[model samples]
Target: MQCRLVVNGFLSSSKFSEIYAWLKAAFEKRGHDMTVCTNIELAFEKTAVTEPILFWDKDVTLAKGLEAMGLRLFNSSRAIEYCDNKALTYIALKDKVPMPTTIPAPMTYRNIGYTHTEFVKKAGDLLGYPFVIKECFGSFGQQVYLAKEPSQAMSIVKNTREPLVFQKFIAESQGKDIRINVVGGKAQAAMLRRNEKDFRANITIGGKMEKYTPSAEEINIAEYVCDILGLDFGGVDLLIGSSGPLVCEVNSNAHFKNIYDCTNINIADKIAEHIEKCMDI
Candidate 1:
């Protein structure tokens, strides 16, 4: 299997490389020819129309444009676009899973004749304090905020200059969350992310983790999310709210390194195997 991987802005665009070195090795271990490209034009020449394309970027060009060019993509462009946008992913899965009470506010969060207290001015009810505000395009919990008050929320809104959504702040979580990694519609691994001091519990935000097991019900919910998106792989983030596990977001390209380090799960190999199967099909 000869392959070319397209990455727009990589995990490390500088002196640090070896971001996808493991997968590259996996492909070569199976005797597949490989190439990595940042420029689509540079990659297009050697690529066969039907050959498998593994895209790590969100440019939509490699996934949509290449698929239109008759390339066999591991994950479709539709899946990437749907998952890339936090608002869309939430809307798509809100009804499918037990989800947080979410309200899509204006990107600017303007008064618009609404009182500062109303936040919506009569359009909608004010939601949880310390609201969870996520930017439209982000990853690794980089664009998340824990706004303890409306003033803080407004401040964040002013700074980001991007559309945002607010979800009920889950006190029970105590700045902790769960991430379930699914491959081929199966829950491969689960972990609990917690930070007693920080409001955001992303590992990148100094959140700590431990090897945690998921209940059968949790696994079932993760599977349901994967089925809803028709995605080959996913990392579903669930907030253990007062009710139960309420899904907050789903990521198309969940990094396996941390989960891989914490649990010693060979998730990369599983993803590699899954991609190989897609190529064969």
Candidate 2:
């Protein structure tokens, strides 16, 4: 079977490129023809799609267009949109899944910015000190921040001109979290990320990772989040809460290289196998 891989054109970092290469090679090893193209390359093309598209980028508009053209995407466009926005992910899984107490920042135009931050005070009052503030659309823990006071929270709101969320900080899970890579509704690999110097436990930001075995509840939550978001595969980050595991974040196109290094499981290969099962090829 022939397939096309769509990646972000602007992301030229070797970290991003490495994942793209591994995915391409994995598909080829499974006896499939894989062609890679940037989202920009197909952005204005008016041609109909002939084969499945392995969308590895967060370009939701392009993914949606391809889906409208009768082409199947591994993780559907809707799924990508839900996972792309931190607020939307919390909203979608609000009552169904265990997660941190998250409140969407009131809508504000980028031009106007936050005129008054009274809402930030309210959020701080509700969530308390040292809560989390995350930009709606971000990855690798870059846009996530911890506010130790109302002043800091308001500062974050004023400085950030994009959509965002206010979340209750899981004190127990500070500087640590679990990443479960789920494919085709199953948990394939799990890793524990630890960062002693930073609150965020992302590998890109100095977090160390080790292979982990997830609890049944953790695996179930991870799989259920994917199912709810209509994702064929995803990486679910879980905070080890005092009560149980709380959903930290979900990635529609999660990078698997760190998990691969920790677990020695090539998630790209599992993704290829899952795609074959999905397409019956």
Query: Which candidate leads the pack in lDDT?
Result: 2
TM-scores, in order shown? 0.87, 0.98
lDDT score, candidate 2, position 13: 95
- Residue lDDT tens for model 1, 239-260: 8877688887887767777888
For candidate 2, lDDT tens digit of each residue in 184-204? 999999999999999999998
Off by over 4 Å in 1: 10-16, 39-50, 107-125
Model 1: C-alpha RMSD to truth? 3.6
What are the lDDT figures for the candidates, one per model? 0.73, 0.92
Residue 209 C-alpha lDDT in model 2:
95
